[model samples]
Target: MKVAVDQGLCCGAGQCVLVAPEVFDQQEEDGRVILLDPEPGEGHAAAVREAAATCPTGAVRLVDGD
Candidate 1:
């Protein structure tokens, strides 16, 4: 799967990081959503989905990698 984060839309809620730390992070300065893996492996798919779904600002975007 492919993942993307819109820093501009991020509200710093940190749900993404909490759900998928390996695929997402937060900027320490302002708690903006950071994309650690734009294209994470299958092992991280579930967490990635959860992160996107739980993102308070809908900053976490996801698309099929294929």
Candidate 2:
């Protein structure tokens, strides 16, 4: 799977980072979402998905068939 983040829509909620720190992070200045692993391994797929779902602004997106 592939993970992408829309920094424009991020509200510094940090939910994604909380759900998947290995796959996502927040910018220190603005606290926007950051893509740590654009293509995370299968072991992180579930957490990535959870992050995407939990994102308050829908900033996290997961694409299948990376």
Candidate 3:
């Protein structure tokens, strides 16, 4: 799986980081969304999905692999 956050659309909600800290984080100054691991470990798929779901601004995007 791959994850990405849209900086323009994110509102520093931090839901993505909260849901999957191993895969996401925040920029120190503005607290914008940051993808720590674009290709996270196998166990993180659910959390990443949940993060994407919980994003209020729909800034998180998930790309599935074959």
Q: Per-residue lDDT tens digits of candidate 2, residues 1-66?
A: 988889999999999999899988889999998898999999998899889889899988977644
For candidate 3, lDDT tens digit of each residue in 1-66? 888779999999899888899988899999999888988877998898899999999999986641
For each predicted model, how many residue pairs clash, with residues at least 3 apart or on different chains?
0, 0, 0
Whole-structure CA lDDT of model 1:
0.87
lDDT of the candidates, in the order given: 0.87, 0.89, 0.87
Error of 1 at 34 (Å): 0.8
In candidate 2, which residue ranges exceed 4 Å CA deviation? Answer: none
The deviation in Å at residue 35 for candidate 2 is 0.3
Query: Candidate 2, TM-score vs. the true structure?
Result: 0.93
Runs in model 1 with CA error above 4 Å?
Answer: none
Order the candidates by TM-score, highest first: 2, 1, 3
Better of 1 and 2 by lDDT: 2
Q: Higher-lDDT candidate among 2 and 3?
A: 2
